[model samples]
Target chain A: MTRLRAAAALALAAPLALAACGGEDDGTVTLRYAFWDDPQRPALEAMIDAFGEDHPDIRIELEQTPWDEYWPGLDSQFAGEAAPDVFWNHVSRFPAYASSGVLLPLTDRIEESGLGTAAYPEDLYASWQFEGDQYGLPKDWDSIAMVYRIDALEAAGIDPSEIDDLEWNPVDGGTYVEFLQKLTVDANGENALSPDFDPENVVQYGAAMASSTGQTDWWNYAVQNGCELQNEPWGDYAVDAPECVEAIQFTADLYNRWGVAVPAEVTNQPNGSLASEQVTAGAAATALDGSWTLGVYRDGLEPGTWAVADNPSGPAGSGTVINGLSNAVYAGTEHPDEAWEFVEFLGSEQAQAIAADLGSVWPGVSSLNGRFADYWAGQGVDVSGFQTAAEGTTTEYPLSLDDAAFSTAALDEFNQVWLGDKDAQAAADAVVAIANE
Target chain B: MARLGTRYPSSTVNALNPVVDPARRTRRDRSTATAYALLAPSLVGFAVFLVLPIAAVFALSLFEWNLLTDPEFVGLRNYRDLAEDERALKSIGNTFYYVLLNIPIQTVLALLLALVLNSKIKGRNVFRVIYVLPWMAMPVALGVIWRWVFDPVNGGLNRFLDLFGVDGASWLNDTAWAMPVVASVNVWQYTGYTMLFFLAGLQAIPAELYEAADVDGASRTHRFFAITLPLLRPAMLFVLVTSVIGSFQVFDTIHVMTAGGPAGSTATLNYQIYLESFTQRSAGYGSMLAVVLFAVIAAITLLQVLLFRKRTVYDFS
Candidate 1:
């Protein structure tokens, strides 16, 4: 009995004993680096490989958490005081993390390191600032643009360039509706413009617009209408403003009131496909999608069949959501200095160029934008519309302290508006109220 | 045969060997010690994974912690908030809706499958494996596939319906159908697994009971009702208790499929807890919800035990 008990104790303690003796006896330091993007993993790995050539003693371990679980996992790790030394940060999530003392303030470090920050946009760099301290540095940027079928424009007898000038309003949807009407076809071969167009049996939808986040959907429209998602940066929840509601209603009008867009039932969560998925399947001829989904289109469909276009103009004219991510150092990290060097490396022109070469996203460095654009041009796809969309008026992502709370609240409430279960105004009011609370 | 005739099956051998002599007390003590040593690892694990967490959760429910911030005591504020929270009430209602939609159908279907597969038939083993494959598949992967299948416009379900000029209802988006659609995935995945338990129970029945029924000229239905059900009570208890517990905690399928939408219609307690704790970072309220969930599960399990305690036939012999 004693032997059996001893054996069991040894069995339990064996793993702990092995765990305690981790890492080689060499005088090498290991730093854990975390990121969420899977497609960019190769580029990040190559960057780390390059980083190792200069500093081989510092072994930077890369941990890739999938997008969905990244924040939740990070939150727990933060509570346990064991988050990675450095990790990627998003605009929506950045505010919450920055407000908390868990993030290492990088203002003094940025000055001490003397890394040039002029390459990144001023606003983009400033977005990572909480109070007076810089919690992160710019990593990459993305913008929303209309991804459409070139053939659909040809079939409708409309020039592909005509889509560039399409404008919208919350009241009538403007020329954009006329364009959508021409493209939206019924099973009887009738366009939405035709007298016999059957809304019941749509063979091809003009567009896909069931995005509840609105980053790739109504947020652009809202931005175009001069409606602010937040009253001011991280100040007040203001999507319930009349202009924002109007933009939301106009967005809904496409799915419900106009009958030109894909039915919300098939497009709304929780089982809804992405805007790119709908277009890839030929369900919808076009969708306002993020530049990150460039790969989804490039991989899912043929090269010449589809093309990207600047977003349709809203009341305030040419608007899209321009968002960027940043690399942040955990405050509690033992090797904060090494983690800062990694973050500094991430923001450098060289790293940005590497990311641009992969066409993963537009690099934060303004000079490297062409490389990102050139990479796709070589792929036989004109992705300049994404750049043009941002070149015009752009709306910064609505980030706030209660972003996590707002995300949960908005998902439930806006899903109702997308499904046509609740009024757009009511949903907007409810969400704004919840967010401000 | 006699091994099956005890309340505690593992204690049968020891029960047969009585430790009556006072001189054998030390040996009994040593044996008892050995038993405790054997159970010690599992007991420690149970304490760590289950009891400690429950206690921590209960304690945390009284405080406000947002993962990033320090936990501050809020006394019964979370509970009071939960009482007034319409969303919590609705989530509970939705959870029950999911449980009701899932459990009864899954249990009955499993029972039917068990009865069919328990018999001698062609490729029975193959059929058994085929039915259990869905159960074996990961819920998240199954959910993604099922989401595609249930897509109203381009899904396989609508395509199949289109063959007969019948339009399929929006399965996951329609509030009326979302809970049922999500529950159907769980039912489909678990019914086969539950069937295996019933199959074991069915096989464990002594052949003499059926023979006795045959001599009494009892009908197959009568024999099943009297001999099969009464004798299978232990299995029924096990299946029903575990199934009910599993059903109430359904999250993965719902998480991937409906995400507690098209208007928070499919959001169950577990999903809500996750959203509050993980997504919203409402750790305190989330912990409170978890405590409520634990209590509800415990209460239901207790009720099940009480209901099944007296009538269950532990030993057919």
Candidate 2:
């Protein structure tokens, strides 16, 4: 009986033996900063190292999760009360995390630190808020544009300068479609404009759009063609508008009817991005992608091969979808003071300038915009198109409760339309039904 | 060194035995204590990792939680909601379809491979290793490679088809073909692993039984049915049970390949549970689905055990 008692006691004490190994009292506070940008990691690390210089008593750890895994990984960590002291927050995801009280409200901290929002765009600053509590400090802003092959356009007997003024309408598709057809080549070496152009044996498409859902693709077209996705921030989704149907139908026709865009079957093969991949491989002449994709393009293609231009103007005029990433602190952080200090430093001129020089994204601080443009120009890539588009009338990617559910449903329904299994109108109705339900 | 007298009656032998040492009871108790001490670590680990989580899943099923907010006690509400959820219902049906597509074909292929390897052939050991190698590779890596192979436009599969004058078809992207493609990939990965068990079972069967069947004027096919198959019941049951459980829990490959897309044709129950919990933040509803899944797997396993209880021939000697 005594031996049995001793065995039971030892068994019960096993986990305690393991637990005792954790959390020794140390004078130095270690803070974990989680973010998802691989290209910007070096700049971020430099910023962190610079912050560590002034405060040697504090150490910062970088937790890099890929974009798709970041949200779920952070959610699980938050559930276990072990989320990083600081992490990147997206505007679309801010509502869910901020409302759940996993994020620390930064309004009071911003005031105490004398970090005024006057230097940031009002919408960008407001994007990280939930119910009037600032939950994020603006990091960077991104907008979409048309990235095209310069040599392909020049070889097609078209002036490269004409790209900036391309226009389109729902019925005629305007000069933009004409330019597309000129660039699109069939296997017989005939351009799409030729009557002999065969869709089945196309060697190169004129343009490509990502098959998946994002503000950078058809959603941008939907808004640019005069569809309102939301009545308010985090409000009802309204994709059933006539303008939305027209925009989606036109985009789908680029693949199914005109055969000028890469098929979804090719574009959505796991990790493949049709727009970027096709353009890089010379399978497509152009892509309508975001400013965030600029680094990838520059890294993959030669500097003189591609150039950026403003997206084609629809009947309603040019429209861009603008979104930003924000730095947010975990509400359950053990080192709130240190985390806030790092987040504050991240918004300062020094960190923003470092981020600007990286040329990966447009720094959220409006004053650093010229510096970013200069950095891109130094790299021999003109980014004036993205800036011009951002300055125009633009739509915000809506922030909603459980946005993933709505977005996933939208992508599933839209994929049917993209595959020619359903019409745009039916898909739009399905998206609206799912969103409303 | 003492021997008990044979003259003593059997009933009184134990009581009258002087050979029993006085410290025997204490020695036995000490050995039992040592055995329990050795078992303690694993028992604690099992309770912590497996038992507690299952209990927590069951408890969470009766509540409404979004993980970020405080859990509210809402008895049976999640289960009730699950009953009406069209997506959840579809995923349940899809999971069954995946199991039906995977198990029989995988088992038959594995058995055939096992049988071929059991025969006298050149480099049979090398072939055995080659067959099991796919199962050893990471599931994530396999899914990635297969996604490229099944790519509709630029994939190797399409290129191979072109050589035969066959028009390439949309594979993973097509709703009709997506589930089958995913099932085939899984079957390809697991067939070798299941083959090892069948090989062991086949080798364990006595050659004398076949000789006896031959003497009874039975042919090879008749001997296989009347002798080989009856003895192979144990391996079949094991393979079927494991394959069903594995099919029910499949998530990573589908997540990487289809992401439960092309109009939700490939969204199995596990994928639905993941979407509900992690993606949608409806952990409570996800727990309900997980509980339902547990109930289903448990019932199926129980049925198989009951059906095989008397049919299995364990006394091969």
Candidate 3:
């Protein structure tokens, strides 16, 4: 009878022992923070340090993953109920994560922190809010801009000042095309603008547009010309709009008809950094890329060779796409308070200024003010155009979770048009069908 | 006889005899049970790891689960979508191209190397080890080293080409050259293993037969065709079928090297399945691709078996 009683006692004690080992302390808290940008690690670490100094009671663990592996890793972690307390989320991917309830709604935190919606640029802030709830705080912002090889333009005997204020109506952008043609010079010392030009032995290119995944502002051009990407938000495919077709055709024609840009066949070469590398190597005159390239090109290229400018205006106006990254607290966090603290610190002006100074990103807060612009100026890059492009003049596109898949399908269809195998109308139709399905 | 004190004690023994036999039966039963107890660990492991997981995957394929929410049953919708998927179709085509490029080239190269090594050469063992070094090297390490060698701008291949005044083309970036480069890398790695099979087949081709062919005024070519070729059919069949299956499932090198890029030029079905499942979070679509890939590999192996059975004879005299 005593042995039976002892066995029951052991059985009861075993579960209590396991429970004690697994449960967290109310006094101490641990938080996990995840992000994809490896280059931003130092700045993030510094911010975490500041957060730690402010909140000594809470400990935060940092998790760094590469961009390609970041999403999948988060998904698995979330499923296992081991998700990080705070994570870096992209606007394009936020909807999917939010819909799945992996992200904690931070509407209350935003209100309590005294950071109003008006504090951020409206579009940039709105991108983090969806479905009547705010899921993230704006972390960093970027915009598309034109980067040019200054020497290449001057050597072609074209004054860069004339094209600086060049405007376009999409219908009457002949001047933009003419400027591009004039800037394009070949091996025989004959410019593309000249009547006696050889297409076979073309040496230098006028412009380069990266149609691949990284920097695609061609959609902005389409939007400026009255092309709707989706039927507002996540409704239906609208890239097949007539104006969108015209815009894509004009972009493709820059390569095929005018011979100013490198053909997609050569430019699409895998692992070939045709845009930045070629521009830096003096093979291409201008490149359409993010303002982030100011740092990359300035550090990579010879001094006094490159400069940044605003994207050329389209039919509607000079519009640019302002892109930003956001930070979210995961729903299944063990230490929700600590995670919120870390996230709030990340949004703090001091952290943003430090991040801006380190050249990590354009700080999301406006109060951080011109620190990033000053950093760019220090690097010998005139970034006033990028700043102008990032202000109220810019537009921010809606990034749904399906954007990656849709973009992949769209680009594949566009490749056929770029190769001249199909026209713009057919390609757009194919892309729409594929994207809808 | 030693304790013969009990003619009356026999009556006492009869009372306890039946109880003693029952106790003996219980002990025998317990020993028999111990044998099954010893086998329980392996049986449990096999059932839990292999059979149960495979069953789970099959059940999971019918649902629309992204490993987040409870799976919602979608019936055959995932499979139906896969059938019309252009990405899956392209991947299947790319996988076939890889197999087509790898099987014939790897088999021939292996057989040729095997023949050369079979010759009466000095330090034959050393040569064999040298040839097999690539097979033994870690695949990831090999991939990184090969990427450096095949780097378009400053690669060893281009430097060598430059020595001959040939303009360096982007080996990995160009769609036309990517698969061939990947296939060549696979061939370089697997040729030695395949060569071992060929070498064994070569050694088994009796010395007496070759001598007899020579006495019959047959040249080396004639002798090889008449003797070595027919006898090595078994090895060739084994190499071809296995290499075809292996090439169809090629993932690691391509993943490390091209990443199914240059606009999805090298995206094989295996790589696509990986991407769809992990990158796109479409496990249902990924499973469908996996099932199709399995069907393709099964069909090819079955075809090879049917074709090779007619040509190969296993009689050893």
Best by DockQ: 1
Q: Which ten residues in a row have the lowest lDDT in candidate 1 chain A?
A: A4-13
DockQ of each: 0.47, 0.34, 0.16
Model 2 lDDT tens row, A1-437 = 33432232233234444554565367888888898867678888888888989988888889998776787788766765667899998877888888888899989989888987888999889888788899988998998889988888877888887888888777867888888889899888889889998877777888988844557677777767887887676688888789988888888777787777888777753345558878888888998888877777888788888888888888788888888899999998988998999999898878898878888679989999988899888877789999898888788877687787777778888777777888888888888787777
What TM-score would you give candidate 2 relative to the actual structure?
0.92
lDDT of 3 by residue, B3-119 (tens): 112246676778666555788889978987997799888776666555554555565567565644445668888888876777788888999888889888888888999999999
User: By the lDDT metric, which is better: model 1 or model 2?
Assistant: 1
lDDT tens digits, residues A285-321, model 1?
8899988878878888888888888889888878899
Where does candidate 1 clash, by residue pair? none
Q: Is 1 or 3 the stronger prediction by lDDT? A: 1
Ranking by TM-score: 2, 1, 3
lDDT of 2 by residue, B158-221 (tens): 9899889888888888888999999999999999999999999899899998888878999988
Give the candidates in order of DockQ, highest first: 1, 2, 3
> What's model 2's overall lDDT?
0.83
Ten contiguous residues minimizing lDDT sum, candidate 2 chain B: B1-10
- TM-score between candidate 3 and the true structure: 0.81
Ranking by lDDT: 1, 2, 3
Fnat of candidates, each listed: 0.63, 0.46, 0.19
Q: Candidate 1 chain B — worst ten consecutive residues by lDDT sum?
A: B1-10
